[model samples]
Target chain A: MKNKFIYLNNEEKISSNQNKPFVYLDNGATTKVDEETANIIKNNIVEEYGNPSSIYEFGLNSFHNIENVRNLIKKKINAEKEDNLIFNSGATESNNFAIFGMAELGLKNNKKKLITTKIEHGSIKAPSKQLQKKGFEIVYLNVDSEGFIDFDQLEKELDENVFLVSIIHANHEVGTIQNIEKIGKLCRKKNVFFHIDAAQSFTKVEIDVKKQNIDLLSLNSHKIHGPKGIGALYVRKGIDLKKIIFGGPQENNLRSGTENIPGIIGFGKATEIGFDKNEEKVKEMKELRDYFIEKVLEIPNSHLNGSKDDKRLCNNINITFDFIEGEALLMYLNMKGIYISTGSACSSRSLEPSDILISMGRSYEQAHGSVRFTLSKYTTKEELEYTFTCLKESVENLRKLSPLTPK
Target chain B: MTLEYTKKVIEHFTNPKNVGEIDNPSGHAIEGSPACGDMVNIDIKVDDKGIIEDVKFKSYGCASNIATASVATELAKGKTIEQAKNINWKDVEKELEGLPQVKVHCSVLAVNTLKKAIENYEETIGIKKEAKSIEEKAYDELKNVVNPNTGNMLVDDKLIKEVSIKEKKIILKIDLSDEDLYKNNINDEIKEHLEHLFDVIEIIFIK
Candidate 1:
């Protein structure tokens, strides 16, 4: 089959004013909505425009499409009949709903303690803190230098008062994949609800929610080459998750709104295609990512962040070049039409260093000098080669002009 | 969001002028912290009469630092030390068209280093005077000039500090707030304004 992904070469160098192919290496922030996904969205808007909540044939068609999408996701994750998916705006909203919903439920049961890691996404972090303000005790598990939460530390923190254990399946910045299965089992043995923010790892990592004993899972479509505005949270049937959004009863009153029909259809199509080609794409993306990592680290004074082995995601490569700023490197690469990001996209605009890296025990300077290059299935070997060339030159040039003295 | 740097900023950043260090320089100064991701080191060669013969800088920062420092050296070269010392960060920002709101600190870094270089030159030479000379008096008057961006007198805000003075060269230091903006051409403007009172040979600033 012909490659449907966008490809750019040196001859087609794109500038800000031009429409040309450019190297895209920041997939962790967001991926290009694949052609199939875009088409589904277009068809849904033009041909199947209906509010899923209305009691009519068109509305029923939209409602059926949403159910099909939910079932597809549930099947992909191996969720059992006990688990049901409810749609929300995206992973942030899904995560907030899961955390705050579970926290509220836990409060009624006299289980006022919440457990999570320092490496979780901001969406999870923010609501957990808000729970603290409402007199719920919050315990943050610290990740090791390689970005893995210590199971022993987690086991020690788990008790009857701890109502839920929320952890990121894969870190968005460093791409470290936590052993969610083991974490889930531990939480199950402790009789605590387990919530996984699998936004970055949903399809990439095969998650059997039933076998893993996951009480809740947060996922979004955008990171999986789907539409941007749709995501879902899987709540285990027995878990009492209090409603966070209230209005006309929708999603069985778990969430209430006119469902985003086009976004939902696009998400379903993307997931179907993503899972069908998962094996080949994983292999291709892994080889490219590893090769890029091996080659990029050859640049002097550059070193990788997170795991050196399989625990890291196949698509992620975060590295720090000593003596130069990451923002300067990002700017230089951006000027060359090689798009990458420094730190987390959520905090990139702020002058502060990556708090995630700081939590992993890196010094402020190391955190400040770090950049992330995330690959997608669309990334080809040739693109990786070109990116390396640009990166090496940019790093050398910025280092030459750097005032940070080499130690 | 991507910061929209001015075209001049892109130019100076891509092919920065006077981008190396000077050996056995008459004056030298460093400002900002690399740990915090903005820093600049300026070296200046001044004549015995206090004229700035040459200036060079090495910066560690985003595009703004390189651009602002490039413009700073271009503005200070061949000007009297007093005039160079009187240069403000606002003028550097103006010369580069304008810097983004966040990058205005780059201009402050450049201007502060230039003044510090002048101060280093004055300290190295035993050009101390028993009384305020004509050039020193002129510097005193020009020293109170307003920061173009803030519109406040430098003296009243205590943003500008007098470092030291020798026979013909004077050094001043500007302590920029974390939020100060940058502009260009304040050096030449100050020199023309003060030429009536002093035959100033050199000036430097430190921050």
Candidate 2:
């Protein structure tokens, strides 16, 4: 189960010496698209230029290419029925489509509430707020410091007025996995539509649509090392959603646009390759995440931001260092050709701290002081060691300049 | 996305100048606030000639914050007290070539902290200065604090709806409870500006 993605050895790397070695640990943001995935995308753009809707041999092949990928994802998730999935722009569109579709059903069924969580992606958070403006009661389920939502709260909120409940499968910031199976069952018991945004957990976490009773699941490429701008939504059968996109009636009238054949096929191949050795990949990343977290917490006044148990994603580590800020640390590491990211308010144009951290009961200061290091399967021990050395020095330097540091 | 900071800004951030405190300095002032995710303490040594001999800063902020402080310290070092007070955020931004537009505010904090440190030094050495009205003092503190929402002063931007000075306490009713990223920094800067004179400060944000 060794990874098919190979890293260049020391001898091979010697030719690219002199320049600082690049070590990127922001896989949670977006990964370096897989080599084979990129090649397929390039080939499709050059060779498979047939329109999916055209009635020709090339177009038929193009249409089949799109379906093949869709079927591949369907089988991966153990979806209940065929023709319930439709290709979309990406995770954002898929999520938006799911929410809007459910909103339509809710309005007709006399349901007045939509239940979601504070830790959802901005797509879900924004739309839920918009629904509130549109007279739908929006309930944001509360999560603990480790990001597990209170089931009691979910149960209490799942009244008959609730039509849809959407949650993230795995958090983008903390990488904490939710109990989707349990949530899906609870939603089923209440006759509510259960939706999950699984962009971060598609191949990384196991998802079973039928067994879990997930009615609407949002998925995408890019985060799984595939080409960007192509994603899909799985709408369970028996759920009648009115079509919102009014165009040339593509995607069985679910989505109406010319298909991105290259991205579709590229995503298909990437997800297929990602499944290869994924269990082993997860094991390696989990071990590395644990070891790295343990080593980092050795620094004075450093804290691990989330739990490090089985519920944590295999590749995520978020930490807050006392007396120093995360953006400064991010830049310091960036100076050494090592790139990581911070969830701090200073990290973005909007000066507010990370919502996920705040939702988990973190103080504004703690959220500002936090940095996230997300590893990929291709991350090497040597690269991590080098990162640790730089990180130690950077922390020491920043702390020395911090008045909060004890003399 | 990063701010596309100039090489000078990166260099200054990587190796900050005059870091930490100066032992028994003639003047010291801490700007920004920890609860707000940024605080800067500037310490300076002024000789009998009223020239700053040494300047240092302790910063808990982002890269631009540190870099701005470093460049401000570099600009303040060896300058006369009056000349140092004249140093502005624009001077710091110019010294670093340019900062990202949004990050230009950090330079404002740096320059203000330096000026406040110089003012403390002037007060310590028996330099008589006129005591301005509390309203004027509030205006002085918030002069450079801009709101990106309006590209104007925070007060002018309606971020702070009301400001009242009651006894020894200054109360500010700000309406940025929606987690305006700048809320903490603005709160800290106001406290930094007026906390020297006012013992009790309570900032309440209205919905």
Predicted complex 1: DockQ: 0.21
Residue-by-residue lDDT tens digits, candidate 2, A12-89: 255555775799999988888888889988988999889988899999889989888988888888986453888888
Docking class for model 2 is acceptable
Runs of candidate 1 with Cα error greater than 4 angstroms are: A1-21, A344-353, A405-407, B127-207
**Which lDDT tens digits does candidate 1 get at residues B178-203?**
33333223343345445555455333
What lDDT tens digits, residue by residue, belong to model 2 across residues B67-135?
999999999999998899888877887888777656767887788888888888888888858989987
- Give each model a TM-score: 0.83, 0.89
Candidate 2 has a TM-score of 0.89
